[model samples]
Target: MGTTRSGEAVGTAFGEYAVRPVRVGEWAAVKALRLAALRDPVADIAFLDTYEKAVAQPDTHWRERTARAAEGADGMRQFIAGTADGTLVGTVTVLVEEPGTTDLAGFPVERRQGHLVGVFVRPGHRGKGLTEVLFEAALEWAWEVGVERVRLIVHPDNARALGFYRKAGFVESGITLPLAGNPDGHELEMVIER
Candidate 1:
């Protein structure tokens, strides 16, 4: 049943699953999935925001967030994976960064690129090749828009994510940022050039 032009179903272990952008009216779904992600066991290292803070956000915030990444947005896009039953199982967002602008970390963008963020998959859906499929879709969008490269930040202790990103053709860029809370922890930057 998943067959929207922008939301083609990618093959999955159980059957077919769609990977597409979030819709304007689907803010609730986006908010729910994000809260679920923040509740995940690895949330501490996997995400920068706390579950408490995310849940505290007003509905308008979620609405604006979804709208900014919806199908018509120019600077960002959020891709979600939906099952045959219409349940969202995972998501990823890509933000276009210009060379002259600064990023969330206050560092110069340096190059026009796609910054991948809000990456997640449900606990039950791990290791089914679904993540790779989602990534393929996101990267396709990034290239379609002419990004020079794509990059994501990962905590050094998050071995699972590091392994997955590496398998997906990303390599260490030799840039690391100090973690805010823990002085010794670092988030390593990984990139894949077009």
Candidate 2:
């Protein structure tokens, strides 16, 4: 995959959709997509945050979040898939973790890597290979940024996502992260080396 500008369009099976990093001014769209994702049926296991929590956040929170990701600085970038008419239908964010730095889970980062998070696609856009396109753009960016490998954590109960990740060439890394609320629950870590 080649590098794409913020609004450059890419053609996919369903139609013309742009798979590119979001612009800083698109904070409202980012917040809306996130809220929609949180409302998904599998969101409880698929995401670490809740719709109520995200919806309650102020505009400044969303603006700052989008600004940071839009800047692609601090090792974070968020890519969104939008239709020709400018409707955002999906998103995926990549966060790079440096060696010796602790991850969000408080686990020590043993190597420089890209961690995929906040992956989501609208229900109507499912089964059309849109997720793969999104992943390709994200992985391309990650590899270009010098990550040795790319990884994502999925809850054990999210069979749909687990199947997709496996099919996408990610293998279990033998790491399990304790779930935030459920002491007995854990997320399985999957990785793909560059």
Candidate 3:
């Protein structure tokens, strides 16, 4: 359920739930839980990639994705919140995007940074502070990876997500990116600097 090798108190709540990186061989469960997240009601604004694309992915795709998050030296992390029953309730993936010619959002790279994405909390688990625990673990991972800044893009219209990011100490970086599928959509870039 977790990276047993790194059971270093990633985060805990009520001593019942733990947020941490998934184990190396848990790719199947990771794939299933992430697919469940993509089906959430607000998925359209919450994700740049779609469920159709994710669901159609082969087992190899999920394997690679999970493996990278679990143990990739390239500085990627995927954290999950699990209950005593072993049910995954929330997830957040942080990828260290190195400075380069261009980015997924078509922004010119300035310096090595961490990009937060694939954030999700099951509807039934909302308001439980699980998201906070997830974010804490993610930020810790970013710092461990030597990222100078961590950023996330949220739709300007999604007030809920904006609040969460703000509460986590992320501020508007005064930057934006054209929404991938809908050019008219406004993506507010928010960041927390190390």
C-alpha lDDT (0 to 100) for residue 63 of candidate 1? 97
Worst lDDT run of 10 residues, candidate 1, spans: 6-15
Model 1 regions more than 4 Å off: 1-14, 72-74
Global CA lDDT computed for model 3:
0.81
TM-score of each: 0.91, 0.93, 0.90
Give the per-residue lDDT of model 3 (tens digit) for 123-151.
88889888988888888878877889999
Q: What value does the lDDT take at residue 91 in candidate 1?
A: 92
Ranking by lDDT: 2, 1, 3
Best by TM-score: 2
Residue 71 error for model 1, in Å? 3.4
Q: Which residue pairs in model 3 clash with each other?
A: none
Off by more than 4 A, model 3: 1-14
Rate residue 64 of model 1 by lDDT.
91
Backbone clashes in model 2, listed as residue pairs:
none
Candidate 1: tens digits of C-alpha lDDT, residues 29-141: 89999999999888999888999999999999999998888854768988888787778889999989999999767789988899999999998988888788789878988
Off by over 4 Å in 2: 1-14
lDDT of 1 at 52: 100
